[model samples]
Target: MPRPPASHMPIADALRARIKASEWQVGDKLPSRAHLAAEYDVNPMTIQRAVERLIIEGLLEGRAGSGTYVRTPRERLRMVRSRHRERRGGSPFRADMAEQGRRGTWESHSQARVPAPDGIAVRLGIAPGDPTVRTDYEFLADGMPVQLSTSWEPMAITDGTPIVLPEMGPLAGMGVVERMRSIGVVIDTAVEVPRPGRATQEEANLLGISVGDLLTHIERTYYDTDGRSVETADITVPDVRWEIAYEIGIEQPEQD
Candidate 1:
């Protein structure tokens, strides 16, 4: 079997076995890398690799200014993407959090008159370099960062309107559907496409996870009654911490 790989695999397996045998309880700090290296008769780099593997597997977590510890398993939160939520009048994220007994809060910044890039332009069905209002958001649940999103709306739709700022003005934080409704846009549909990806360095830093961790990237767009794309957004969620759930409502046939 090609010499069974190398030293790190066996070292990682040994550590995993110890963890499985209750040798380290949740929140218990692991021994120093040097100590583990000496005990395993391997280089410190080898032990580091082993620990990193465990961390990626969610069995351990690294703390800054502290050491690695057995991680406390967390319940995966469900982020519901439902047509019903789209029809709701207020913040869908806040409602979702309320359903799970957690407070949902977000901080956002908006920049007006940003030129739309090709990708965003395609989603919004507008010409590239068209003016837009762009808003970036960091959403938290129970005061912990759980999601990130960036949304764009064409300036042609809401150039001088109160809802143009997204997170400011009178209709602040009411969500796309409600905000557009206030302007008589009447958003009729929303579409979302979810893709799995590796977390980038910035994403890792914000979510407090290792770089390259699993994440779900969702591209969502809302269309008005006339099928004009009114707003588009890219949403990011950590895979280890949340699961995306879609709630579909069945349409009833006409009753004679």
Candidate 2:
């Protein structure tokens, strides 16, 4: 006898509840689709869909030629970025890790005289093909890779200066704002735009995650009070393992 269609969402919810309640303990294989379909009086396709949703949600994991089993999620690292911390002119990653009694380290690679593309040139207020310093950074906390950043700064401003190369100067690791301040450039503002992205092969390789995993892409630009862009960066953080927090001061409008 054919059974009426059932919503897979409710089935997924029910399975998730059981998993959370430990009824289906970690490493326990979930029942087969045939059995679930018979028990719920639903189509086999519905059962399959419900299981797939649970797999994607990290409540269950499917093995090749084996049944799906409950999953034990890894511990996540939480990071906080705030204007108050920025005033201290330290690595935000290091500060956040220190709060949790963890250590953070990062390595950077730089190239000078790299030609800026059209988009970068516009943000930098320089002509297309203008030379700039480009640097790539990989940050790890507790020896686990957590973040990646690629930044560009126009050479016209830093040419013949001691900090032209980001990681090679006496001011190495001091941060862009501080380094620029040393060179008489006072950074007044920064803007960030965060968007959801899928991990690429390189990102997956560095972060040790599967390709196509969800990630957060943040485009950040620093500008001087004169409205000139001083630096720009593309920052990447994996969603499955990190929770990014931000703090800002909101001022209320003056009452009439």
Q: Which prediction has the highest TM-score against the true structure? A: 1
lDDT of 1 by residue, 1-256 (tens): 2223246889999999999999999989999998998797777888988998888768899889999999987667778889887666789999888888999899999999999999999999999999999999999999999999999999999988898899988989999899888989998889999999988999999887678788999999999989999999999999988999988889899999
lDDT of 2 by residue, 6-73 (tens): 78999988888888888988899988999988888889989998987776556778889998889887
Q: What C-alpha lDDT values do all the predictions have?
A: 0.90, 0.85
TM-score of 2: 0.81
Worst 10 residues of 2 by lDDT: 84-93
Off by over 4 Å in 2: 1-11, 32-53, 62-67, 250-256
| Worst-scoring 10-residue span by lDDT in model 1 | 1-10
Q: List the residue pairs that clash in candidate 2.
A: none
> Clashing pairs in model 1?
none
Task: Tell me the lDDT of candidate 2.
Answer: 0.85
- Model 2, position 29, has a per-residue lDDT of 92
